[model samples]
Target chain A: MTDTSLIDTSPQGSTRRSWTFTIGAIVVGLHLVIGLSTLFWTPYDPTAMSGGRLEMPSLAHVAGTDRLGRDLFTLIMIGSRIALIVGTGAIVIGGLIGIAIGLLAAFASRTLDDMLAAGLDILIAFPTLLLAMLIVASSDGASLWTAIVAIGIANSAIVARLTRILAKRVLRMDYITASRISGTSWIGVVAIHILPNIWPTLLVNLALQFGLAVIAEASLSYLGLGTPPPNASWGRLLQEAQGTVYTAPLGAIAPGIALVSLVIGVNLLADGLRDIADPTRRRRR
Target chain B: MSPLLGIESLTIQAGGKPLVSNVSFSVAPGERLGLIGESGSGKSLTALASIGLLPDGLQASGSVLLDGRQVVGARDRDLVPLRGTVAAVVFQEPLTALDPLMTIGRQVGIAVRRRAKRDGHPTDSITVMGEVLDLLDQVSLPQPQRIAEAWPHEVSGGQRQRAAIAMALACKPKLLIADEPTTALDVTTQAEILKLLGQLVRERNMALLFISHDLPVVAGAVDRVVVLRHGSIVEQGPVATVFGQPSHEYTQSLVAAARAFDDALEIAP
Candidate 1:
């Protein structure tokens, strides 16, 4: 019913949108290539040491060596694998749980709504980082995924709250009313009428949530609150490089740049989805 | 004669405030009864309450009977089976009454399919489409198939109302509750719609509960007229008796207000 060619163009009439898309595609492409290459081989084992520590861009090490004499380039590649995994995992987990709670609160009126809202409010009131740290302390040590799950759990209340408010408003719209008037039950109204319209909102919101999740997981790893040693996350690599900030600053600078670039790429991708998913953008076009 | 539709002492309270209180009305099969009143006069509330479709938080009492079977106090589970089988509705703001996202054809097909599934009636989707086209033809919608394929927004106000009439008829319900079905339409479209509805009622021998604020439209379209003011039945009788000689002061005032507007429509004071 719609022309694919028209959709190919980004919502921002400006060329910046296309440039951002190209940059995102390249970063994502590099991330995938870097991750999958681990299944095959890196120039050197990511954790293996070469001749000496702080060996700058030698013929053998490619991107130079860390304080521990580990190849910085291989560490960067391996770190991306964790970043992609945690980022994707957190969004899926948080999005699904949040949407379930949201739909329940929106459709089930009064007492159920109050119960869910109160639960979310309590969770939201707690400090996310301190709560995650406390959880990690109280529980066993966290893995890369544990940090991701903790951050995702901490942030799900925002998604749930936003989804509930949006869903409740949508529940009162004429289309939903028509569904009920047509002999469709409340469950039917939500599944058939409400869900379809709110899907675009969910998608755009997911992109933003995933971006935040990546940053959270990376920070926790850097603070030694994430996946234990021998696991390389962007945060852990950056943490390991802290002692070498003087002579071999590239040890910190390389992973640091990777973390910022990945975050920037995800945020840009989210902006793109926002423009496309926004219904108002349709009229603008 | 058995009334095709009967509402007895229908009381509806919204937040402890009565919207329709102690209201009673009935219509025989093949008969048309107009419930006339000003805006917010409980006429529409009575119609909605009769069908057990009033919004939540509204309390309803009294008996609504269809084919002599009480329905008003019936359970939610029980009320649904009778919905499209025994009755259907046509509402004001035709486009809003319809699902804007669904095609008119699908809407009609849904009603027909629901009825056929419930009753074990013969139902080929194509046959149902043909039947819908026939209804659209009956409502005088030119290019019925094209109109059926169009969304509610694509059509003019008149076509949307015609589509609504077609939907209300899709299940072949014996009672059709038309609440301000013509109020949003233009004059020529209003005249055509009222005439079409009148003809449909006669042709199918169905009972009609016509709710509207316009006195002349109701006067011309119905056999009996019940005047309501502030949730109470003020006056009622054979259309000629009630309109020619209203028994209650509120009824007279309603007629006077209607007459003052020169058959266009009166703004109720």
Candidate 2:
């Protein structure tokens, strides 16, 4: 048996501050800062067509103006706000409902567990984008919150499935049986024993889901089922910039870069969290 | 007085097939009963049945009485209060018995709080902390304070086993079902754990159901021995009578093997 002193505790506590995690945090943080800042100030009004069309990058117009004569920088900044809202909103809706369903399935009787598993399998078989489109189509018109809700519902099935698998694995451990025999309530068992053991993996999955959420929102907007006109969605920006790409490529390039970078940042954050969650891996590193 | 624990023809079935059939035994308060059986001899199943923790898909048909209360067919709601107070269990694997994410103190504190709640006593942090420390000390762990704060993975195998026992003793249960509690420890650690269990049981006058596959291991710790093979009791008597003059062929063979194991250990060093 390995000596108790040989087991290091710092890896779990310190890995959150590691370089990969720090960089990820910064990337996500900058988008949040830009998103929130846009609520108060922007160089030019994003919705107002009060600038020269297809203007080049200048001191006054950092990213220049779009073909609609709206400030490109202002549009990009507000687009960041839309991305953050949809990403976080979808994640919250999906993660909560998914984890709850998964936990219920895990603790339920064998027949019920099988039923839930079958239902989740059917839900997963449908492509998330197609499911979101069907949901959005049900509404009279496209809107930001509607799109977020649709994407969230689509994301829930995947999250629920993952939670069930991970939670079932934890449930098999002897500690769970011991906890039950110790008279811990079912809720207490999940909170104190099951959750802590399964959180690391669930967290990583949630992070990846967050990244997928951002992309899903962007895709919806690009397909005209997302945030409607007057709101500057990055996907809308991509769509608007496509026509004028030959003349003003930066308009398209800026939102594209933001979308990719934010998703990359979230993925990187998930990787760092995985390392911290498993101390043996952190120690090996 | 009624026995602290009584098993009247306890039978366990899986998928309509009998796995353990009509196994009967009883342990008076403060008496140590050793259940000797091989892996598939239904020893562990009997122990689980005693506490109503049979695995999913296995139906138990029998009466398990603890202090004259029927536990075998009791609902989980009724069993909750009984567990950790009337009776508690220590599983075979110490490594997985204790919650890895929790401190030893916190884990033991849970059992303490549960018992206090059952007795209609309000529990404060100070009382819980004091009780946790006391339980650790009772298990003869080194530096109760240090052990209380340590995680299960941060302790030695012997220490972990001791902590598990402490948790089981937290409720001051009248019956302690130790199911191969020391099977995973080193030879020396095993002996220490067995001794600790024996001393605690004797001091508290708790009924002990010690289940193990090793016959010699049972001999030192129990007053009576029940030998099982293929889910039926082959022979059961006082430890001296069962060991000195076995009546069943299976019991005789088991005794022979146990004696051989002891001889091998003696000649090794």
Candidate 3:
């Protein structure tokens, strides 16, 4: 059942060799490895203030020390971990909630479908960051979990809208009708036919959402609405580095590069997956 | 005695307008009935109504008795399990009828497994695979083993249609409703599929409700014919009486169209 040889491997098999996909995988892999390794060890303790404050890059501290005299490299490593957590957590919550709501809307009767459409329209009109801010504020200041939940909820509206449209299109297919005629239960029809048909498009959308989630977490942290003190996020590191920009430009540059690299990796991956999933597009290319 | 499948005074309304009004028909065991009409003539709607698969907002008010069971107004839970086993359908477009993402084996295996479960038979993977291969073989597909492993898109249109037919017959239904099943195939393939269906229905002693717009095609396969025009049954009787001497204007015109197509084909280089 899990045989790869049984699959139609012409288009998807080549996707891994595409430059964008390969590069994206490399960058994302590096981030994940660094982030996970931080669970056990970093070059120096992330919170310890042993190095001289505002030190330049040197053998003892390769990326140099921060204003608190803690290792900048260690802080960035922990920051990557935070980014991974928020990115994974927010996407899981958003994708699940959004896909479920979308399926409900697609399966609902005409009147209820209209109501859900209208409600989704209203939600989509509300900017995600603004909604996240409101949620965070309502939850009484930022923490790691609160920021993740807020971002997740905010991101869910977009995913729900996309899922509703994709699922509706899938439900209209003749195979879906045939599946129903074959006595497949509604849930079985959804699981076997509807979900698989809509998955490629939804996956591409979710990948794009992952990049946005990382950026949203960073923005929230920058605004002092994410991962409150004692933990370093890439966004928080940027915030802490802003005061000493001229003296230590690497402080701002390092986290900025890291943030941009991760987002780029995700976007490239989405592009590659989109090409592979849509065979017509892949053929044209 | 009640027929194997029956419909009486079936009226389908969409947005307060009747699409199919006051239509009635029935098929007994081993009967081959043809439903012939032009597009939008409610020929397909009647079949869809029988299967309880009418689209949303389209309401049907009447009696549909399948194997002595009331299908019209039956809950989906009741209709769902009754479908495929009681009365299976072969849709016109084979490409869209089969799931593109799944292998032909997997799709056929699902139907086989459902039938197995209903019959209280063992449903191990090997048994399912053997059943799937047997179904593919029953449809006269070349290389049943390779065909089972192939995806729907990997097979030709005719093969796909055969695969669809195999899946439909997996449950060994009492009545098989084929709605324009061969419309998408080539002339030769169409004839072969019609012959295959005729042979299978005879061998299994299953009732067949064969729907098509072609009169000659209907003549070739069915024992009786029902002509529909603008949501009404124009004329219906034994195929010999209807085709040999069509009474209604609609039936005569349909027969004329079919004759003209045949004449044109004969004249082609």
Best by lDDT: 3
TM-score of chain A of each: 0.87, 0.92, 0.90
lDDT by residue (tens digit), candidate 2, A1-285: 333463445556464548788888889889899999998998777788867898888888888889978898888888889988888898899999999999999989999999999999999899988999999999987999899999899888988998899888888777677777777767888888887777778888888888888898889899899999888989989998999898789989988999999988887777787767753445432
Best by DockQ: 3
Candidate lDDT (C-alpha), each: 0.77, 0.86, 0.88
Report clash pairs, candidate 1.
none
Give the residue spans of candidate 2 off by over 4 A: A1-6, A9-17, A270-285, B120-122, B267-269
**Chain A of model 3, TM-score against the native?**
0.90
What are the per-residue Cα lDDT tens digits for candidate 3 across B1-269?
66988999999999999999999989998899999998999999999999899999999999999888998899999999889888888989988888877888999899999899999999999999999999999999988888887777667889899999999999789999999999999999999999999999999999999999977789999999888888998899999999989998878887788889889999999
Ranking according to DockQ, highest score first: 3, 2, 1
lDDT of 2 by residue, B1-269 (tens): 78988999999999989999999999998889999988999999888888788888999998899778898778988887677777888888887888776778988898888888778877898988998899999999878887887767767888888888888888788989999988999889999999999999999999899999877789999999999999999999999999999999998898898889879999997
The per-model DockQ list reads 0.21, 0.46, 0.51
Give a tens-digit lDDT track for model 1, residues B88-108. Answer: 788888756666556778877
Q: How accurate is candidate 2 locally (lDDT)?
A: 0.86
What iRMS does model 1 reach? 5.9
User: Candidate 3, which segments miss by more than 4 Å at Cα?
Assistant: A1-21, A267-285
